[model samples]
Target: MGTRHRDEGVTMAERPLVVPNPNDPRLTRRLKGLDQDRQPVLSDVVVERPLTLYLNGQEIVTMMTIGDYPECLAVGYLLNQNMLLAGDRISGIDYDEEVETVVVRTERVTNYEQKLSRKVLTSGCAQGTLFGDVLEKFREVKLDRTAVLHTRWLKTLLREIGTLPSLYLVAGAIHGCALCAGDAVILYMEDVGRHNAVDKIAGYMFLNGIAPHDKIFYTTGRLTSEMVIKTVQMQIPILISRSGVTAWGVELAERAGLTLIGRARGRRFLVLAGSERVIFDADAGEDAGA
Candidate 1:
């Protein structure tokens, strides 16, 4: 058996990477806590484990995640941080449960000492970090203008998101993200932090060679600068959430021409940026221009 990478660059197993079961007991623990009525009760809580990612044997950064799809997290985190190049050939991904680490091996030598030296805490709930100016490439990046989101399709997607079985539904302390092709969700991931969910989805897209231009990204967390930047980096145009958006997020979305939709729940939702891409067939409203 040899290592495999996508795009015929490296070789992997015929079967996909072994992703941890979302319902795995190891990912959650039974804890004792007091309820609102001050009653002591035992409940299941989501687990947070530290995963240190190494690129080409060099230590990168340790991320606190829910311990699912760690391979994707490692590769996706590196990609979003700009440490991993688009054409970089990934030779292998190795995970050690006892050590709690993930190493991403690439055919090309990778060193990001200078980039990792500079780090800024982002607005992500899990306290996401950024290596360099994550927005540097946004100026040249343009989303597909022809991509359109129908009002009905948007509603259908939200409804589907609500019906999905998630960690949040069971433990009540996680954020989730969904990658949708039209009204169908291709992948759904949840973690203790929203950033982790986004990173997992990014990893899935990267490894599976999924295109982003026509996909819709939905998150259970508020739309922040970090979320907006990561979504754009994924080259996804439409971002929707049941929560509200921040000023910086709105500004960035407008500049990058990314369709930003937030506060979406039920029949009431708002489109804050890239309004022209939204088709009002269901609502018959005016174009949601920036």
Candidate 2:
């Protein structure tokens, strides 16, 4: 449970909480598996459980997550789905770890029976799912045009992200997302699904009052229409990925004027849209060097 924040204020994290730690025993479990030599070996696997979310006493959705930052994920999921408005007042949040459930209480009454009637299978890892109604808002949302990214900062950002400890490195079965301001990582989240990770970051931004302009959203998953739409909804102008991009994702990015960069491994990356917002300050040859 949480205390109530003023109408214009945000409820801060009551305790010091660390998330996405690969070494967290609660999040990872050791299991027996066969190695390349066919010998039985102990392996680490990321733990996933059903996280059911409730909004104002109504069951919203059940998500498969790695059991971290459920509060953020719940709020972000509702926000991105358009079930929660920008001016909505959140009275409090209750998270039950044992039941693996989170309830978001808002002052305003909400319902999404019709929106939930339509579902779309997204192009995200862990078989991501999203509401079909997000399309209309996706088309109407416009990101800040003034946001820009420096090529030099991007190269460094990718290298740093690789070095950060992640569930993917420890268990090999998770996706990660990070919020960055000028190449510095602000928040990092990982879950069974890339959409979950992005939602967690969105929740963090909403609760912490972090502005999206000049911020970069990075993911280890490919850029898909779902990803593009969610990034734009969060008001983040730039998106980066270590994977490739889908055609529909590119189209949405172009429509929203979002800077989309993918294949950001080492120093090589392809800018699929909004190249005008990027400042190529790095030396051409330096991008190829160690």
Candidate 3:
């Protein structure tokens, strides 16, 4: 099932798998307060609430999110945690908004008892927790190294995502991740945490049967190992961020042969890994201020 509730933003929520609905009143709140100078001030703040996820009969994790895409968030969390295999057939996804709970049922006999016994923490905010040895699967993923990310496509992508009417621009405390095919965004998701944003996209992709080989992942958050692992898990060829990268993230990208780009804003970006796939077809003056 798709997002049960949605409202049109300036341009988001129009097409694509999903996009931020900044105009959705439930996602934010209007608070009345006074400034330091004794002036009346009204502020729009993001609404963060608990969302508990269940894979089959077992509880997976309870994530704090903006509460729009509960179904995607639930399924994506299980997949990102490696609790749900990509080949696993999902029977149904049940979401109950009143209790803030979502359950994902599968046709295959699902079990993660051993995997659940181990938990690993990483640098991706508090939401960056994973179960068992993700590296075991990480090592086995052979990314399509032949995929290319053209400089011209990168510039267009930066411009497209930056100008999007999103919750980050509407309110201050939020994170966004986009799934792009070439320079065009196919899905743009946002939430209280960057992990939630990316996971929503992952769930959407899985449900829609979208191929990841030629896709690029973009994020407003830092390039942490969590980001690298999630992008690699999706089998996307390129990962770009308008923020800096962590050391472990770069190491993982190098190992996976994933094109990792960071500090991508206004015509300046650094490719720390898999530079062989970047085709520099654009000049410095072309979209220089993007």
Q: After superposition on all CA atoms, what RMSD does each candidate show versus the true structure?
A: 5.3, 3.9, 4.9
Provide the lowest-lDDT 10-residue window in model 1: 1-10
Instruction: Put down candidate 3 lDDT per residue, 1-290, tens digits, no spaces.
Output: 33222222323234455688889999999899898998999989999888888888888778888998887788788778787777777888988888988999987777777887898877676547876678788888889877898888887888888778799888889989999876788899998889999899988877766777778999999999889998998888899999999999999999999999999987789999999999987675556444
Judged by whole-model lDDT over C-alpha atoms, candidate 3 comes out at 0.84
Q: How are the candidates ranked when ordered by lDDT, highest leading?
A: 2, 3, 1
Better of 1 and 2 by TM-score: 2
Error of 3 at 92 (Å): 0.7
- The candidate 3 region of ten consecutive residues with least summed lDDT is 3-12
lDDT of 1: 0.82
Q: Which portions of model 1 show Cα errors greater than 4 Å?
A: 1-22, 283-290
Model 1's TM-score against the true structure:
0.90
Question: Residue by residue across 1-290, what tens digits does model 1's lDDT show?
Answer: 12234333322333243222557887888899999999999998888999999998899988889888899899889889888767777889999989999999988887788887889899898789986657686566778898888887777778877777777877888998988866677788888889989999888778877678787999989999899999998899999999999999999999989999999987778999999998877655353220
Model 1 lDDT, residue 40, Cα: 100
| Candidate 1 Cα deviation (angstroms), residue 203 | 0.6
